[model samples]
Target: MPIERLADLANPATTPRIVFKVGSALLFGAGGVPDREWLASLVAEIAAAHARGQQVIIVSSGAIALGSARLGFAKGGRGSLADAQASAAVGQIALAGLWSDLLATHGIVAAQLLLTLEDLEDRRRYLNASATLGRLLQAGAVPVINENDSVATQEIRFGDNDRLAARVAQAASAQAVVLLSDVDGLYDRHPSEPGASLLEQVKGVTADVHAMASGTSGSGMGSGGMTSKLQAAEIATRAGITLAIANGTHASPLARALGEEIGTLFTPVRRDGARKAWLGGRLRMKGLLVVDDGCARALARGGSLLASGIVEVEGDFRRGDPVIVRDQAGGQLAQGLSEYDAAEIDRIRGARSNQQEELLGYAPRSAVIHRDQLVLL
Candidate 1:
């Protein structure tokens, strides 16, 4: 089936899983404090979705803003990474408290999740995080997700929650990712440019489509610029998750984004199988297994990776580690749990299955990576 139109997309009745990315501008009102009126309405919207059996997750960005005020820093002022980290630590408590309290008024429970990039990269951590979020939804609680700014360095920091929200959508297998920002939607040119117009529905994020995005980070209250949001759109749409960019300043922005057709909608490809879905997301693999063209073809045909097909193994990883399968040309083919250790695969690369016993101490029970464990990309 083709993707739905804006009218259908806005109707909360259609989407099952919705990830709402709330920027600092929406969370902090003009006075730089938590906006209870806006937040209350937003919770009401989420409660309505919950009553209808729809799962809602919040990817919020307000810890730094809230923390800065608590720590006596100027609003929207620049600070060192250490300062920012301290602010996040202070603000996270207040932010979580506000969410919990406001959500309680609507008879909904709020669960705070602080995540670092490493959590989403490591296979074990990724699975654990996803399971925890999933359980919260099952129990009718909303997971309020935020980056672990307190400990993050430049290398590990997501910089903006825009891309992080996209990763969350993929991990949760959410149907749609709604980025509620200061702007209403993407425009043909910079909104400041005279005669610029909004692009209602974006079919593909081509170079031209990306060109439509402005470089300016929306408001001083937030860190993410339009560029990050577009980058996020690319990630989510490719993962079979629809994305919408809309204004979040008003009440119940989630419902408005889904029901008004006012935001820019990025269509998604058809969802893949469970295995493929797991592999396609922004997961961190422990190593790489470069294979020959024949192996890539076999994988495409649903075949397991044989030792004979491996050209090389890069990185030192243990058995049961998540590894990426790439072709000799350095293109990714699949990702799976490796049955053999790095040293073992290094010794068995390009060797026939029958020769494993003579080459190594013991013969393996199955292929290097079984079909069940592999996900072709």
Candidate 2:
């Protein structure tokens, strides 16, 4: 959908699309309940952005905490898996209701989506979710996403919303992401430690940056910390998306941070295309496809990896699996989505397109890794 207008209220650098991530600590105000007044201010900011034709998506935490409060127990409850799930189950309702009501105050609808880590890992499911978020924005609804803790097993959960927010930014093709937590931004060390200083702008998330990270939040309601925010920066930067770590405890967090640049901003590294960003952002690789020097040259020229150029297919990868492209010297060159399974690629490796169908006894698809599916490393 086309943006109808643009204004200063929207984030100047990334106005068209942005994701705002609110952590539980900020959502859980005094007395273990949502600070309705604070939330109302944030919602008003969102409404203003919507009016400016800046699409906004929210990744919010606090369901489990809300649920725990409703269960009339400590947020941890018994600290068991069942207890956690029960809290999330009850809290999701209240949390969703709160968001709906707050957003509805401005005639905006809040569309809730609960996603597990597995959903973003699978291509089919990821595409489905990406499309759904797009449609929601076109329909003028703000997408309020949260990790699917209610039914997700520990193995399939995100554990923290920081990285989840980055994944949602990638999925939504957001131009920027703002992580709203208790602290204003990332510090050189634990914020309370003597001499600790806030880093205003991070060019990249390096080892030194990781060294600066602190542990999980001291606030009992939160799971993410500076370490996870750095991890999130790594994910978002690769996708060419700008990310900010900002304080959300007060009202109008977006206006304060985005307008005043009052946060730690991580800039984008590449801006070629969203598809390439997705490939660059992907963390999983099913296998490696080693190519001849000729194939490597072709890939550099923006050509696909035809079977004829493949010298080796390593791993038991299935069709459409993500794989790294390597040169003859074992130097990583690119990563792409493989069109053929490992067994099939092995059979057809070094074979020209004409010979592919003859050897496999079936008509073959195009490139082993199409150019559109590949990104230079």
Question: Could you report the Cα RMSD, in angstroms, for every candidate shown?
Answer: 4.2, 4.9
- The superposed Cα distance between candidate 1 and the true structure at residue 71, in angstroms, equals 1.6
TM-score for each predicted model, relative to the true structure: 0.76, 0.77
Question: What lDDT tens digits, residue by residue, belong to model 1 across residues 1-377?
Answer: 33476555434567778898998988897645888988989888877877777789999999988888888776443478877888899999999999899888889999999999888866678788888988988898999999999998888767889989988887887888889888789999988899989888887577788788776676677888888898888778767888889888777776666676678988875566544555555546789999999999999999999999999889999998889999988877788888989999999889997888888888665798998888765
- Superposition TM-score, candidate 2 onto the true structure: 0.77
Q: What C-alpha lDDT do the candidate models reach, one value each? A: 0.82, 0.83
Clashing residue pairs, candidate 1? 10-258, 10-259
What lDDT tens digits, residue by residue, belong to model 2 across residues 265-315? 787665657667667666568899999999999999989989999999899
lDDT of 2: 0.83
Candidate 1 Cα misplacement greater than 4 A, ranges: 1-3, 9-13, 29-32, 35-41, 47-53, 73-81, 104-107, 117-140, 152-160, 170-173, 184-240, 249-256, 273-276, 328-330, 354-361, 364-366
lDDT top scorer:
2
